[model samples]
Target chain A: MTQDAPRNDRPRAVNGHAPDVFKREGQVPMREYPKNAPVDFVIVGAGCGGSVLAAKLAEAGMSVVLFDAGPFFQPRRDFASDEREQEKLYWLDPRISDGDDPIELGANNSGRAVGGSSVHFQMVSLRFRPEWFKARSKLGYGRDWPVDWREMWRYYDEVEEALKISGPIRYPWGPDRGRYPYREHEVNEAGLVLARGAEALGVDWAPTPLCTVSAPSGKSPPCAYRGMCKIGCSINAKQSMLITYVPRAIKAGAEVRDLAMVGRIETGADGRATGVSYYRDGKWRFQKAENVVAAGYSIETPRLLLNSSTAQHPQGLGNADGLVGRNLMVHANDAVWGEFDEEIRWYKGPPSMATCEHWNYADDDPSKNFDGGYSFMSQGPLPGDFAGTLTSSTGMFGDDLLEAMGRYNRMAGLKMVGESMPQVDNRVTLADETDELGLPRAKVTHSFCDNDRRLQGHGRKFMSRMMRAAGGKNLFETQSTAHLMGGCPMGDDPETSVTDDMGRVWNVDNLWICDGSLMPTGGGVNPAMTILANAARIADRIIDARFD
Target chain B: MSQPFRTPYPGYDVLDKWDSPSFDDQTREVLRARRDPPPRRFLDPNQFALLEALCAVVIPQRRPEPVPIAPFIDAALHAGRGTGTRFATMPPERDAWLRGLEAIDAEARAAFDGRGFCELVRPKQARLLRSIDRGDCRAPEAWQEMPPQKFFRALLLKQIVQIYYSAPAAMSEIGYGGPASPRGYVRLKVGQIDPWEAPFGTWEDQA
Candidate 1:
């Protein structure tokens, strides 16, 4: 079991020496490893799953070498108390575009930091709907997983405990609810409005299960409810991979090499994974290991595999099934804005203090034409973002329009997030273009089908009605492309999926994948919980295999 | 004269309240030459004058205040570069497209002679803005192809909304604390939440 370090503990220099004289302040230290140093395991991508797996495997007496392409983010040191400083840290890569287009196609703003995308996302944790695992059987659209939800429940419980997740046990508005494990906070206005609106429409609305630290569960502090949850939390109240798993992994004797880009995975003639080849500080390095795990996100993992071509598997490593880069999924999101007569003061609390899980599960009701559900975002925009979004919507110009904006600070908004079924066409491939690093950046090509459009339309209508019921005027709906699932899918059939029950690639032994890419179907709720659960499950399997 | 004035400061013309120098040719030239105009950039003097007239009509300077319209316009045009080639060249193109706009403005001024856009009798400025929004150019397609309606939308949104929101007064109007305050808050939240929002449950839960 991991114990919390003293509150004032300073980060120990690697290899038990003083801080490197050559290293810049706040820069991740570089280490020279002997060529082909043998390790028990090599975990690629130091995000959530890779960090967890590294820690777990290391704790089990294995020498783990973890690599991430981004720098190791020293939160307190690298971040500032000011919000603008924070935006600069998060959005400094000028190469990352910000328009409503794909990054490969020149859209800005996706996380490319040490902790990967997690370093820049809104912390919304949710478990996969049980049906998500068996979506192929129920939805008749995708392949079913080799393992059922029950097999992953133990890992889910373990992850929740490890992460110190605290929430009411009985899910609000859930069927057959049990006693809550912890006290739940009162719903915020946005959540309350959504609940009331859903009730008025005779739709079920319940408290959203979030991973936020509302009250002290372990060493983490309780949430102050500042409503700025989307930004990096200065108080460590919001859990991120950098704070939670990566630290624990480092403490447990795992060596993390940030800014180490893995170029290819090396396998033996027998088709078992041996190690990985990577680039760091202008040199090629190979680390041999008994096992190799790819925990890079959906886009990177498949790209890595496809890029790693070998004589034994020329199409790609573990590409015998030709399912390496197929079946991508992303949620369809619609936002609705409602101008209120009274000030809402939305910037004072978490970006999402409350969400309605009322429509998380598919309904067979005759009145509802779609099978997907929606989650309601309670917190509206922060002042600047709100101003930007609001002004963009309306054709407001000049100082006069600016003066008009000051009058309506308290307007509220809602976002409706719906799950999209997996489709082979929605994919992330290597773009014709390459990045400064010479790696082919991920080219994402995605569009919604008629079913997705129908779901969004229905969801928008329902959300608009709810806003009106909540005493809001000038209700306007905004559309957004989702940034959720795809790349790697899990199943028993090697012909259709990349990984097996434990996220182990079907064709390659000791090569596991644990990230959003493994999700077979995108659920309406956030995927953080499921990702952690799946990572934990994979770790357990690795432990049971006695790879250490 | 007996009608109740809608404004809080009746007869208080803030337009006459400023002491700053009016936008002059040198200032305009300096602002115009800031960046090498994108290929085929087209904002000429007459078109620029027309754009200024249109902006003044839409958001007239208020009284008893230092409302710097030129600075605002300069900033808006500078910031609007590369938003698209069409928008970047709008100031120059305004002269080429001046005839139709002049006709429209004449009609608008006729409808409400001395009253500003806000003070105008209903539907006058609205009618003009609607025409501009709709790309209602009377010129032949040969002379100057009215830029696409989409280009106008981008220009309007960029200049009117994006540039306006970036200004300090405009920020105050919307209660925006600039990107420094609330954007930072959202960034912090995103940092905390983004990683945790990954498929993994939470940072601590990952193992």
Candidate 2:
């Protein structure tokens, strides 16, 4: 989609009457900063990470500027219930994806708007398994995160409380973090199928911890079980960064600029990040800041860094060790669909309401063929997405496609977020081609390892048994990947990682990479909550160092 | 159009909830736009005709009014709308569509005595499309930058399927509740149906 399409065509307050749904009350208007005057912190990408950073920094009384390439969509006015119209929420900028097993990079891994992919993310909020943070030491695989799980637990608790995550009172896996802020929601039929299968297979299944509110919060309503979680939620019930952190950032006096594409990080002769040069309002403008944070996620973050190569630093800002765009990871997100005799109209609640994280937590089990594991959930895909899955995932089309679609109500699905091993070769490099913005496009090269394939194969067999145990037949599997991570990884050693554990670039003193890009290894779960927790930790560290 | 397609929920019309709380005002606008699709903008006259024929084979519908798949796709391409990702091997969306249609037409002409894809019969078109889907591109020259099989899966069939399912008629055919906004589903357990939702059955009388 083009960057110029205005999202707010319909006014929220129509005829002096505010709609009961998506009530926008007590939202503080975002502050604006002068382009010439330097702000304390200029964060690129007002998404999950950027929004959190901006909120934390601004709340700490820093003059912050948050920028995003896409619109600041007010969901009540901008979003549509239709899938075709809602496709605008995705990062539709035509990034090149290539490898031995080429990844499909649109709706699954990217988003453009201020809220970013969280705007349309299925709200499967999960914590990293405590051992995954030290996978190298504990599990004998993958890179070890510099941050400890105990320290990360505080950040996760903060994020969970802030977002008001609705989850079980006592989570089965990991350390007990006490009760969730809100109670768990009712699991749908698709979730029941998963629960049934989990019961038969003797695996733990629980109503997933989700960012979508279960009880009514101030101004924002609770979830209405609309089943269109992958599209932008019209109601503010989804608790996206758009509604949660972005608003908090604004309220704390952060200037959130939408539709502003940051082109380069302006560095000075002193070897420090000075400000940022960006494209906004049909002209290239400079926003001077004391420090800059690249929270543009994996692809764009690395692309921006590589594009901002200076005379002093020829390779890139944080590419001293040449690890800026290296070690890109995407979870092996494949689905197994089956048909049953009974009507299993899966589209009733949030797509992933119930989940089984047994595989992810049971890493030491001798039955496991792979080093890492997966967490699969029952899926409630809308009709349009389901149809697309049928054609792309399976080669079902023509009369056969129509016949299969006729049995849409009878179908149930289980999709996995399996852990994939990170290789340096799987990376984001600058392509020869340029985008409409005249910036070098990011060419994401990714391929699954043997461990990844084994994990997926194991997941397929596990899901098949579950589906059959739930009396589902004619099962078929579809291969795909989701939740991108690790381009500018964070570690204790600068030579081994792009950024420090606190997300500071080793070479660039004032610059930071504060997003999922800092994630050294993506755990076997949805990465949103973990990303938020990482951002919170980074923000806290930045705040702590600010007074130093 | 005769009612030949067998659907479990026979009489469920999603459009019936158009005036209900199920659909919000923005959803109504989106549906209206789809119902009255924009004229073909990106595809040339030949390509447009070919796309229409190809879509017919892809999703052969027997409705009172078939969904205008080709026009919607052409409009999206004209507007440079994408899901924001593309295969490194393939050309851009517009180039892929043009090259794919051209290559498929070339295949049809080669297979059926120099007649283009639009001139071919339904069975012939289906056979040609199946070949393209299977990566057996006879017209290698026609597919310059884009792979035939990739164009079929990633672009052509994907767009067609997505567009078809976006229509209200397709929603009715599949027994989908149109748009749950102000009023959403409550009874989400097994064998429980919301009063507004379509009942489960394959009875012919309902159709």
Candidate 3:
């Protein structure tokens, strides 16, 4: 655990263990700055959503201030150390949230640095199933969303173009549709084996759509196929916010103030947002803006609104319906590993490069009572990570055991990423504890429903069958977890939601909540692309409003 | 036409320097204090000889140069201090493992006499390893502390691969050149939309 020193002239230690720094806590003198200078927009949390919003708004000539609690890190300067040290400082150490049992909560590995979770993610760029938007209407699980798939699809295309996402367009299993031209990667021996296995099981597999820039992309180089996608990519192949959206926002004249933590949102008596108060450089600073955007993730966004108490709305900002932090949903996932007779060299490419979506859509058969479809994640971890994850469940050691480690380099594994239904009980709230910075910590209370567990078990069985068909030896099941979402859901009815269809707060006219918090349901695919697309759509709506 | 890949980022040169270790006076002292003679389980040349004999029977050298298992065991035991806890438990599981190997050697000596475990030829070594792998060894204490089969699985799957995957020769075998290799490639085409079908059906179907 490396500690960051104060930005002032203080000699810092390498491992960040300085007692004097902690002892001098809360002692920076606050300098009074004019709070009268106003900006058109203030976007909190400089993640994928906030950064994209900043770039689009700044390009439209609007004054935008982007705030992120994490410190600004220049990869060349800050991460110039060896991969091990860089991972210790920028990747491994700060990622795991300080709490009891952080790993089980999915908080242990999520990034809290300047780039947000995008820095540490595997860069698997996938879109939601078109039917996901209508899950509520189809299954009678929740309220229907105000907009349809076509509205979101238009924004998805805009985001894909903006982010320069490149991948194969055709489905690997079904008949060809007249879509965009597809790009393909030369399947490695391990992927070929998995493909053969899937074929043997009468299933289809294909190259995955990764956010990485392949050969000959301008400014971004091709993936060296190091299979270290979870670690911060040294090469600019992975499309993290630092490389993609944040840089473009900076170039468009948006001021991204890193290390700036927005503590509270101040609302006016007329039910409008006045400004936000933040802590930076160990001093409280107030920034006044006509419009406020909360993109602080599923947990923090709602917590921010709920924490902000105002005279106009005593309960919280835009909490008339009392639905600020409710209806949280996370994807149900599980994995299966396969040992083969021949060497597969599974750790040769990205953590994931292909997915099989044969079971993604839910069947209409009432007797089945199936939860949702599942995607086959055929990517294996690097040797070190693989060994750690594989041996975590089994107790193996000694000389003979040493020989098995050699065989692991050639092992391949598959994971089932399935969707869980939106449950109101599984949610995020403010815990009794507070962080070192004197802010209430976000506490997540989540558990899989019976349906979710059933889906997971079924997915595991399917993956096992696929591996067997692929001629895998010594195959077995692995554990899985979920990511929190849909706490402050967006809907047409102000009675049941916090944000409107355009992501604007129902009562607070100028304030908006972006990020996964506004998602009414957890889609059956990775949500990064959808988050960016929605952010782009909301930014367009804000620009069209022409706020003065 | 030779097309050089443009430097990915302008400030990436600074990362090269960052990657290089800049040892100061204090770091040198810490390094000196940390340095010690390898423990008996790792340093004894007989341990490497035994490890080589066992790995040959398990994985078997497919081609010209089989994986050198001794270095992996030595490094994993050394590196395991911080990265892993399997070897650092009570009774020192690694030491117990070494004791298990010694027991196998004692059995071999009892059968063959006056000769080291490795000197008894390939068939003898294979027979000894297979017995240990199958938990046919005589030491009940060592087996109770660390099961032979479990230990064999860990040794073969974790530590051995850690060493092999890191070696340049081993990497060349799989045609992998790490993330920095210049041979990497990604092919991109425009107008491609995702083909994943909708997970849900139409409103009429639901009705």
Candidate 4:
């Protein structure tokens, strides 16, 4: 931020209008909204879920206003294109961490800007398998979704189509035996290196199925593989909500006000949803809307619901059972590094090039030491990544550090996406610390269970053996967590779950949630694609049932 | 442009062989500092000299140039850059740094013929470091009271190496292209190299 901070202050004026503009391709679109405008639907957070709902509702001829605390991210115009300046994208206000296995949080956990985490993710969009829906029945530990994957298959199809997702002709172990919209990405150098390991272990591996466009489709363009996927994508390659849903919503006459932080969900005397009270530019503004949707992802969603406690529902909005912030889950992730004999420049393409889902068939094999299974994905950090974090993690610093760094090109790694058990203790509560806006921060407490240890231990040994078989030496492991889920789960029981089958918050008539927070179980894969699909399905329901 | 690095490993050309970089200004600054680092603002001249010696022995570079490592650490410390959270095992960065420096000098004087750490040759420096690493430091009263072994390995050695390798010169020596942001790599297929990538060896290199 010190060197290449974005100059959002100097917005390009358009047609003698004010600097409030959405520069699409080249054309600058602008409009002025009255302070007290009539709003039919108000969606909180302008990330993947919120942005998708906004686009869908606005397209169906409804007056919608989407709110986000972060500034609009115009990659081509504002991005520094450097990883050092990547921290500007993450939501790093203040979040607590407590776990037996140490996982770094700052830039890795959540993204703060317009498109939210989608704008700064690796974009490995794996759909939830049919068995994943009935996790509670199968695992005998977690909770099951009220509606199964059969009910939401069409929405998944629609999202894959809309996003132009590219993949192999078949995902042998995919959900609903679904085919990808486009061709899979070509196996990059990292994938090739991982292939050697996979072949040695007799494992099946393929190019990772990603929502990121592999070729030009409609308004979306193919990925150039900048290797900064976990950072903000500078080119219009990665199909985040910023380029896809957010812009579409704007085109459909939705007002997206940036830097507008929502304070509380305003409710009437009869416990009916009215509008939202938010802080924007040193003022508390209220926009009256019939329906209010909270799509602020996992951390903020629970925080918002708990913080918006009315006198009627004293615990919080839809917190009658006091189960708003519980069952916090993340992929029990581990990164294993392999120093090879040959050169492998991993910084060029996508870091996560391919995945081996051999161990992820959780339904068939229930006799495992771990409750759930794990998958292996490529982990390709750049030179700066090595010099900063990896080398420190390797425990070889100073002169030994230079020697280890000398093997930078030869070094390749893989992240083990092991499933984590959702413990009641692993929860997010309101911390005593309040932000500048007097809103309480999400106090997080997470720990690995015995199953987590077994999963990671088995995975670490398995990955190391594969690496060695691939003629790799000096194998090392760094413990990490990715794709956080749960907190506000969706189920039939209002006493246990926050939302119902349709992602509607229990006991609240016009309140809805369509984000990772609604996930009952953190599947063995990434949760973003499922979040998108769930949002689409909920948006459809909202469109059908126009409020009375 | 500078001549390519005569790297120790084969199967891949040195990263410096590339004519241009796709990274932004901050990356350029990081690379530039590796060769001609700015003056230290945190550590005094004595501490700076000691750190330079520590860095040299820690990551012994045989380059034609004096590989810059310690200056970045000095700059980072001067800027009061914490690593998000402090280690429960270690003291504050600046205080720990000073203690570690004095302890290193004490060990050097005790081992060598009354010579400070920086005064010793590279081999002698390595020997002194190994002693500190093994928690064998019997230091003077001037040295801060701390766990010698943990301090050396965790903070002193790890932090410095991280700073050193974060530069372009260090990465180029090992064939790294750093951060590719605006101009992303397109040739992602296996066994195919992008036009801008380092010339890698065939399947023969895999063996």
Q: Give TM per candidate.
A: 0.72, 0.96, 0.69, 0.82
Candidates sorted by TM-score, descending order? 2, 4, 1, 3
Residue A94, candidate 2: Cα error in Å is 0.7
lDDT of 4 by residue, A347-426 (tens): 76677878888787744554456767788888777665566555445444444555566667677888888889877778
Pairwise lDDT winner, candidates 2 and 4? 2
The C-alpha stretches of model 1 lying farther than 4 A from their native spots are: A1-35, A81-84, A87-109, A173-182, A217-219, A267-274, A282-284, A391-408, B1-172, B176-207
Taking the candidates in order, what DockQ does each have?
A: 0.09, 0.63, 0.05, 0.27
> TM-score for model 1?
0.72
Model 2, residue A314: displacement in angstroms? 1.1
Model 4 has fnat of 0.39
> What C-alpha root-mean-square deviation, in Å, does candidate 1 show against the real structure?
11.8
**Candidate number of the best DockQ:** 2
- Given candidate 1, what's the lDDT at residue B15? 19
* TM-score of model number 1, chain B: 0.42
Question: Candidate 3's residue-wise lDDT over A366-403, tens digit each?
Answer: 43456555676776565445544554445333323334
Comparing chain B with the reference, what is the TM-score for each candidate? 0.42, 0.92, 0.51, 0.77
Candidates in order have lDDT scores of: 0.56, 0.85, 0.60, 0.72
Query: What is the CAPRI rating of model 2's predicted complex?
Result: medium
Instruction: Write out the backbone clash pairs for model 4.
Output: A398-B58, A398-B59, A399-B58, A399-B59
